[model samples]
Target: MSLDSATVRRIAALARIRVEDDELPRVQAEINGILGWIEQLQAVNTEGVEPMSGGSPVGQAQARLRPDAVTDGDRAEQVLANAPDRMGAWFGVPKVVE
Candidate 1:
């Protein structure tokens, strides 16, 4: 899993990044260093280790949820409360990437 200059160039092309000829060696060494760290991590034994989410251990604490009591009131007013621009019932956001 070592990285070479050719592999670094290919990666830059695939990521749509422009790299100078002199920068290739530095990029290759950096990527190879990252790969070496990953290889070291892969050599560790995790036979009894379990996966956890968001820094919390499994089954350590329960998440709380609001009560499911249904009440419909001012649905339109609630939706338009913080809209920067609005036209009656609709929110007006600026056109994007046109």
Candidate 2:
């Protein structure tokens, strides 16, 4: 599949890219080449291929299971003592932006 100049400009606009008039041909050709590669990839036959999780072969997986626990260690008061500028219950910092 080939991409035209208008489609390339639309794509550039949708992607928030600035494409000048003279660069449209190069951009359109590159997009057409990418589409052609995708078309070529679609022609490949994968009849009996099993989908693996995240491209890792299922046979080589060794995941360590851990317990899911939600417990606050009650260290909030202890940690807030080290703040140089502490408001009532929050840490204050100098403004870094104009």
Say which candidate scores most in lDDT: 1
Write one digit per residue (lDDT tens) for candidate 2, span 1-98: 77779889999999999999989999999999999999999999978886687678677756777778888868767888999998877788899999
Where does the lowest 10-residue lDDT sum fall in candidate 2?
Answer: 53-62
Per-residue lDDT tens digits of candidate 1, residues 47-94? Answer: 999878778888778678889888875598888989999989899988
Q: State residue 54's C-alpha deviation in candidate 2, in Å.
A: 1.5
User: So what's the TM-score on candidate 1?
Assistant: 0.61
Which pairs clash (backbone N, Cα, C closer than 3 Å) in model 2?
none
| Structure candidate 1, residue pairs in collision | none
User: What local distance difference test score does each model get?
Assistant: 0.88, 0.87
Where in model 2 is the C-alpha error above 4 Å?
57-62, 70-98
Model 1 CA deviation exceeding 4 Å by range: 67-98
